[model samples]
Target: MRSGNIFLKRNEVVFVVILSALLLVVFPMALDSFRLNLVGKYLTYAFVALGLVLCWGNAGILSLGQGIFFGLGGYGMAMFLKLEASSPEHTAIQSTPGIPDFMDWNQITELPAFWLPFHSLTLTIVAILVVPAVFAWIIGVAMFKRRVGGVYFAIITQAIAAILTILIVGQQGYTGGINGITDLRTLKGWDIRTDFAKEVLYFVNVALLLGCLLLAQFVRRSKYGRILVAIRDKEDRVRFSGYDVSNFKIFIFCFASVLAAIGGAMFTLQVGFMSPSFVGIVPSIEMVIYCAVGGRLSLFGAVYGTLFVNYAKTIFSESFPELWLFAMGALFIGVVMAFPNGLAGLWQAYAQPWFDRIGQRGAPRPISPAPISPTAAPAERRT
Candidate 1:
């Protein structure tokens, strides 16, 4: 069994490496600027989906508040961008002095204390990880320690994301309100406005996505992964086996939060802005659907699912804006009803017959019933 697992792991690694090389080499050349940007966004979403797969797919925790983590990271990066954009020199040139547009519009004179730390790149990066980790830890301890599961946990997490959006919108002066923190000039001194810089951002997004995929794959094959799967299959059994199931859940939850935050930061940098709308309940649900439609246990499934669905959305929206949602809804229903394992699983199942055919070509066939007749002739005759 150990050897088999080792072989399987090697195969998985090879597959990932090959696919990554193919994507890096071919997609950029084939796709135009707009399509490449769209694909990059999808790749960012794939990172979020992979995180969800690690938690919900393997650990049996259907967290619906991943957007909160994503938002935290996005807002973290956005804050830094805003601060850099609003430096003493830039602020002097702007129409309004000593404040951003939203802050000025909202009649604000002083920057909030919390926004001060975001000025430093080091602090901002730390906040991006620490903020989401702390929040996930708190939430996980609160719910998992109490043994909350199923629909109840989902509802609570979804509510958390929902409330976050409202709070961010309500604090217009600090959080940019409904307009969001736009007019981002640079990311860590790289001018986001330039095509070359945008391309660099695109490559960064891909690298992060690949990194997340590899992390998820590693965790999925680790002892922790086995525990997660065991807990998913039989929580009581794992608990009875003397393992601290709640702690495992908490760990995976925190890990997923980190992944979401990373994805969010990449996404914000790519778009050159961040907004509450990007981290609302709708997006949270969409993230969940990405994992579901991709085949929850498959890391690459998450990537494929996000890319396929979002690409489809862009095309359908352009062609039929009024009915795009309806079309997407129908597509989701179709996927759920016809392919419970999702598109990736559907392809695997369909490909199995071909694989079997290939294997059969060189394998020896078993002899038919004639050999048994000598020993069983009397019994056969009696029968």
Candidate 2:
């Protein structure tokens, strides 16, 4: 039991090594700038998938509004970037030169109070982390304390996403409306539009993702993780045991929200925009699909799933715009029906075992019964 804390299992260690190599070494050397950038965008979604693995997959909480957290994070970062890009000099043509262009276009003379904090990069970063977490906490506390969960909670989250999207769109002066915050130029004084910057951001994103993975792994191996699993499988039993199941649920939910937010912020940096379109029901469902398709129970599967689904989406949409949706729906249906554990499950069930068999065949076997019997007899006499 104590050994769980000291090290990851050998397979986990190998998995991490392979993932690091692929992300850090192989992909960078192989993919061109455009493709690499696209992969980076997909990696951002992986963050949400990782969160789902912890919250929904482990804790048995299914949220259909993850896109809400993602959008908030992206918008928080985008607000700062937009503010920087909307400097007096940059927006000299506008009547309100210092305010965001959307505000100026809407005939607003003064910057709203809420947008003030975003001017400082430090504060923006803080907001990126705090806002979604706070929002999630409120939602979690309200729902979990009342024993609202499963499909009802999912529906509530979806409603929240829809409401938020409408609010952002309706309040054009504040949120950039349906268009979302765009024309993000730089972080501090450094330009982020260049290919060099994208490369740097990709590496930064990967480092953050790896750090999150380790943290998730630690959680999954901890005592709290066991309790959480117990709560998931038998909430009443855990509750009868005097454990505050609601608190655990809230904690995981908020943690998942933060993860989604971080991904959103990274998405904005890499994609250069945050739109209400992404904050709605569809994107949130898409994120869940990513988690599901990757094997929700597997952390590494989340990333692989996000990439696989997004790549499939892009490829299918490019070649067969009309049939892409149908194709995607069919693929999802097939995956759920045939391989409920997603790609990760498929790998574990078949690929990993196949590889293990090959390894066993190649390895020399030394556990002969005659040698073991002779050695055991001598050791038995000494005992």
Name the best candidate (by lDDT). 2
Instruction: Specify the highest-TM-score model's number.
Output: 2
Writing each residue's lDDT as its tens digit, candidate 1 over 200-291 gives 77888888788778778778877789889999999999999999999999999999999999888888887878999878888898888888
**Candidate 1 lDDT:** 0.84
Clashes of each: 0, 0
lDDT of each: 0.84, 0.91
Error of 1 at 77 (Å): 0.5
Per-residue CA lDDT of model 2 for 250-282, tens digit only, reads: 998998899999999999999888899989998
Summing lDDT over every window of 10 consecutive residues in candidate 1, give the lowest-scoring window: 1-10
Model 2, CA-based lDDT: 0.91
- Candidate 2 Cα deviation (angstroms), residue 183: 0.9
TM-score of each: 0.89, 0.94
How well does candidate 2 score on lDDT at residue 55? Answer: 88
